[model samples]
Target: MATPHTIAVAGKGGVGKTTTCGMIIDYLCSKKTGPVLVVDADANSNLNEVLGVEVETSLGAIREEMAQAELKGTIPSGMTKADYADFKFSSAIVEEDEFDLLVMGRTQGKGCYCYVNGVLKSQVDKYAKNYSYIVMDNEAGLEHVARGTLPHVDTMLLISDCSRRGVQAAARIAEMIGEMELKPGKMGIIINRAPNGELDSGVKAEIGKHGLELLGVLPQDEAVYRCDCDGEPSSKLPQSNPVKQALKGIMQELGL
Candidate 1:
């Protein structure tokens, strides 16, 4: 089995992580470098929208069903718990021409996030080996890492907006990753939604304070904003789109 190289994107909410994930997938697909397994690990899932797809099911929903069934002692007659889980997990993936997407939707009325996260980890551990690349779009903060949702990350791209708080959030996440010993092969920071793709000195100082490698900055592109307004898939952004081009350059810089 080929070991899949996993790229997990983390950032504060509204920091453009989902759009960046979509662009990464698009670039990979354009280069014929799939099949990638795209994981929307955010509770408030929106990667499907960015990628121009609809999620009919999610791992959270599946986990909820399994929990209910287990309570009722219902294992679908002949199937064992493990087998049934594997079956349901297969259905949760949305197959696309370039890659497959798995969404980790909200765990409703949560008793604890432990169970669902474990299930997601199990599925990713099992399914990821079949792919050459696995790109995970994580929820805000470090909960996913703490839960072991992503067993390993080849590249951890910490994204932040132009705000000081956003950079602080990324720095905190990086600290968490280190403190938890979830060391990825490479880790870097991306400043998204930068004004004219330029960073202010204060922002640079904050980044320096955390010693985060500046992967690159994504310009505030009107095309991306327009697509969001008109409900267009960001993955369909034109090849000349500045945001897309900048992300491609960043990916190249990482030797992806």
Candidate 2:
């Protein structure tokens, strides 16, 4: 089977990373790019809300259950613990028409998570071959990257707002990628919520100083804000929405 094209989206909090990641997933699915796998690796885990999907379970929850299952005697007879874990992990995937979402939920109530994390990685690797693309919304801390958990990254999109601090945070992430030697096929920055889709001179200077590539800019669009306020999915935004259009163009430029 062919390997999936993996895309990792990362940024500091409040930079609209999840929203932009949702738009990318929606665009890929809408364009019929092929089956996509969406991974919400962010601990806060709101990618589903942006995509208008509901998730009842997560890998973290399954891990916790498995941690205590032996004591509780929940593993069915004739099923190995690994087999039971596989079954539970499969149930955590939230299947949608366009994509399947796997949320790496936050660890709870403290215990060594290494075993479950290994299982989750194995499951992701198994499922990855069945998709054309895998889009991940990562937390600002790059926990997956630090742990070397992602199967591989084809493209890394670092999201940032117009603020200097946001750009600096993105630059730091870029630096971490280099330090970790996780050389993705491509890496660039997408400046979101830019007023009129234009960057200030200082921000431009900062980008140049950090040597970060500016993939594209998404203008501040009230439509996106309105959708959030109305409890609607960002994918529900009209085709004319500037943010959507800008993301489409960015994806096209990347040959996605």
Candidate 3:
């Protein structure tokens, strides 16, 4: 088990990916075992909402400086861009109980974020080594890591709704993974908002074609919706909630 250092959660929008990520974080925190780092790589910035953290810092500002550093080549002679990039990591990290979070807010311009996002890759890769588990709430797609921004992860959880579009999106993401050659330890599907029953024939077949393990499914739960409306943290979801129980199955299946 190659350390299982980092886990990236990705999927189509409205797939409850962020909520799933939060549940994973909750599971990690329950253990008296290790530190958990939550990385929010979504431009929409909802991981903070799921985790119930009012984010005060983000990777955006440091990206501005790294952009300047890369363009000017003024990072103290002999230090590689990656070496100078470490400082940005220290400054960018935001710590909290049981973990820290690094939120990648929106990118402003049309130009690429190559300079800083590149630096972020190595920085996060190094930071990952220190912890037992790292949970990333990735974007709608995985273009960031595919383009070499976020670090190589262990398991990539592509959460999807129980819909044809979700199934198709999962297939496309698997293709993207191959094209990028980001050989994660494993990749799988977490079907959210699906009824707890035998997998639908078409759904099983679609998932089969991709060779992705059906990690688990979270049935539609009003607990989630009601709580969300009230701004309650997913991690603190009541034990009676079906969503929490479903997520427990997910983590157990993954051996988290």
- RMSD for each model, in Å, please? 1.3, 1.3, 3.4
The digit string of per-residue lDDT tens for model 1 on 58-116 reads 99998889878999998789999999888988999999889999998878893577777
TM accuracy, model 3: 0.85
lDDT of each: 0.89, 0.88, 0.77
Ranked candidates, highest TM-score first = 2, 1, 3
TM-score versus the correct structure, for each prediction: 0.96, 0.96, 0.85
User: Which model, 2 or 3, shows the larger lDDT?
Assistant: 2
Instruction: Give a tens-digit lDDT track for model 2, residues 1-256.
Output: 7999999988898899999988999889989968999998877789999899999988998788887898899789999987897888999999998899999887787655565556667888989999999999888888778777766899999999998999999999999888885789999999999999888889888998999999989998898898889989987677778999999999999999
- State the TM-score for model 2: 0.96
Report the lDDT tens digits of candidate 3 across residue range 1-256. Answer: 2243688887888888898888888878886468887888877778878788888656766676777788887678888876776666587777888788887665567756665566566667767767788898877877685686767778888888887678789878867876775777878887887776245678877788777778877787777877689998877787667878877877777777
lDDT of 3: 0.77
Clashing pairs in 2: none
